[model samples]
Target: MPLLTNREIAETLERYANLASITGENAFRSRAFQRAADVVRDLHEPVIALMDRGDLRRLPGIGSGIADAIETLVRTGALPPLDALQRTVPATLLDLLQVPGVGVKTATRVYRELGVVDLPGLLAAAESGRIRALPGLGPKTEANILAAMEALRRRTGRFLLGTALPLARRIVADLQGTLPAGSSVAISGSVRRMEETVADIDLVVSTRVHEAIPATVAHLPLLSGIVRHENGSLRVTTHAGIPVDIVVVDPSVFGTALIRATGSADHLALLPEVLPSAPTEEEVYSRLDMEWIAPDLRLGLGEVMQAKAGTLPTLLSVGDVRGEFHAHTLWSDGTATILDMVRSAAERGYAFLGVSDHSRALGVANGLDAARLAAQRQEIEKAQRATGLRVFASCEVEVHRDGLLDFDDHILEALDLVIASTHSGLRQPRDVLTERLLRVIANPHVDIIAHPSGRLVERREGGDFDWNRVFAAAAATRTALEINASPERLDLNHDLARRALEAGCLLTINCDAHSTVGFDALEYGVAVARKAGADPDRIVNCWPIERIEAWLQTRQT
Candidate 1:
């Protein structure tokens, strides 16, 4: 079979999305396709390999049908069902979704209501004032539609970090395996800096021979085509449509090339000096008379000045986290039981675990009522004795639009911790949402917020709250914000996490673990934390048992 990338698999899932959207199928059915696409698109390994290893089902969004479709695509390079779906949906109408404001529903509505089947048609409709007169759309939406169409025209080819990082790692690993024994390769550019999106992956290499590297890269398992192969650099697209650039130079110039490649253009402008013959980034920084700035801090965002001033933060590391919080069990929507969750946290060497199952408001999650909460406390006490791990029986209480918590005050005060958050009404107006969040954060019983933004990457946008105001209220109330690492919800993304920290707000980087294996996602939170310049001293969960206990006492009634 020819080389097949995960991109091919993702495209097939998209077809399902198109079909369901046009036919007005339920949201769940269309979302399955979108979710599956997200999983495959962000996956670092080729889908074909996962299919071969029988590991497809372990992924979050892949079910049996999607897995079968992936296998079919890998084996035959096409899916018959997807091809058929494409036939019903006009290709031009589907293309309208490429514009910024036009979603599947909006595109379908325009196509049906106004016979606007493409970008040009949609633009004409908006320009002629026909779009604003449609049932759901108004002037504001029409203006956005026109602007988004223009933005789409100007948009460049860039992959979201969630989609590109995994694939980039796989490609570099493949190159490392194929390169000559003494060759050295390191990722450069936005990937190294952990940008949310990037146009391409850049790699810097030092090898015994120059031509040998490109020839070797061309034959990597995922490589299907080459764009350019030059004396110093090579550009190629993986079978998954991820573009990569590899730059090879003599060992002496390797460090210089690396600094050049890892640059943000502006950062490189700060120093015309280059360090050659250095094997690592540390040496480059040392030669330039500065501390080694972390790659995430190399965004030319005043990091150089801080590096020179010796005030750069000692960022948090994976080893710093001492507890697990915001987890779930069978008491709520989670699949794991309380004991299983406790044991899993214990295995990871966590000193404490906060089991915050959902409150009774979320019917779908099987959220616990006050009686169920009291019973859960008994189980938690038993687990603490059995596992010898600190167990904090808690509830992820939902805050209603009117600023009321799911549980009463007495119930909330009795718990070890209260994680207040918004589960519904995410699309409320900014002032209303911010006020409700402020009301929750100020509650003496509330200790933390889970997935503060309520955003799911690639699936949903974050709520439109005034983050600065929320951060201010949180700082005053001593409410710790969360850096949720669900992959789908890396909320308070690195950027916002950094801003919140600067605003004197503390944060907890949590896996939001739903199952035993979900503990592995803890590292993703730590990555987001480090990228935000967060330090162990400020991350509540990274504190020692003594500090955590003392802090808990300050907040607990």
Candidate 2:
């Protein structure tokens, strides 16, 4: 047996907290458990080690109650509270919690009244007009739930990109070492494209004999079980439960094999042509008199035509980003101090850093009020003076459903930048959400709109809105849209990002970092930008500080 990763343990606690919330537990107690998960995630050491040393109680935010819960999970692989709640709340209601707008109260109402047991059941109820009859719910909410469940179905059983990428790379590296010197191995499929969710890791090995694959793969250390082995491919599950597929081919046709293997299937169908024995992917494209496409852009979404016409835009790279506009510090909910985050950005060779903590409208994020915002600005300027790095004070002002920002004009006008975001009252009608966002974008003080879609990757569905209208409003108002780089919320995902580009909206790739290490998420953002055919010319963060500062001066009311 292996010790559970810190993230795994924290996630288990988080689910327990959610379950507790639905099972009629005290609100404060449930929040405490949720905070404990955050504490464990932030701690650098292996939490299991702390338990073994009997020091779990000493960990910050770990009270005796949480400590006991942690110990039970580590020792027995289950939480007693969660187990008890499952019996009381029924597995069906717990499953319902996975839907975005369907909260515990709503779930409870539906469960008691309609006995909604699963997504299909919920979908049927909503479609048949049964859900609208529940207390506090109406036709609009039923539609929202119906859409959310549809989105959830598409992502069911998929692994997050961040988790799957590293594991896939490690497996490829290990497999490379096991093969003969002449052979080469590469990872393809969704891992290569950086899709938010992946079904399985795809591996392609260019080696002489197809029969050579299974023997070495069979003896690998991590292999827990084999799913299948036939026709030059093998399917297996790792001990960690990640699914993997291996495609073996001869080295002579390595390039074509890789291109075919790294496809969306639909993307490959649009390829001008495919040929064997192309030494490299570039050559395959060159053979058809087309420009090479980024692996991330192989989405069957007109890249082929763009290449043929020589109109393919150069995509944004991690190297192009120069600053961040959405970051948090201890003044808000961030784990890092302002100066620490600034120093990290400076060390990364960034030209500037924007310390944009959350505004008071979002109290759950430890958002700052006007006074705290002013105090934070002073601290940021002090750091700028000492570190010789440009640190701009900014705020992520909330866009209220009533079409107002969290801060007044007087407060917002004082900041170097304002990133308006949607946080509270997200479950509004499509027209209402669009109008609220349009209002934020139109604010002369707001330079950017962070996480425009308000989607949490695979976890939550994007709020229903008229994005075309939002994009048109952002363009008209000169409000740049943000590509939030956080792994959990890579908002402005590839598809919508491309659409934003077409709508002529300028974009910014920001880390929305909460800690020093969060800057690393910039790479993921760049990956998304590239996938969407975005370029430095349209990404404001790619500009030098002088340019960005000059642009900021123009946004003031």
Model 2, 1-557: lDDT tens digits are 44565666787788777667765566787889889989876654567667778899997788998899888887788878778777766566568888877887787677668877666788889999998887679887887888788777777767878777877877777787887667788998888977777898898888876676788776565554457988888898654557889888887677787888898787889874646467677877888788888788888889889989999887777888887888899999999888899899989988888999999989899989988888888899999998888888899888877988889998888888899898655667799988888888888999988988888877677788898999888887778999888878888887788899899989999989999988988878898888888878889999888888888887785
TM-score of model 2 vs. true structure:
0.78
TM-score for each candidate, following the candidate numbering: 0.78, 0.78
How much is the lDDT of residue 182 in candidate 1? Answer: 88
Candidate 1 lDDT over 1-557, as tens digits, reads 65566777787678677767765654686788889988887775577667778899889978888778777777888776667666776667678777765778787788778988677888899999998999778887787777666556656666666556777887778888888988888888887776666788888889978878767886787665568887788888876687889888877777778878988887877765645457676777777778887776677778888888888877778888999778999888888888999999988989999999998889889988888999999999999999999998888999998989998898888888889888777767899999999999888889999999987665456788899999999998888999997676888899899899999999998888889988877766787888788888889999888887777778865
* Model 1 lDDT, full chain set: 0.81
| Model 1: how far residue 222 lies from native, Å | 3.9
Total backbone collisions, model 1: 1
lDDT of each: 0.81, 0.82
Q: What is the lDDT of residue 454 in candidate 2?
A: 86
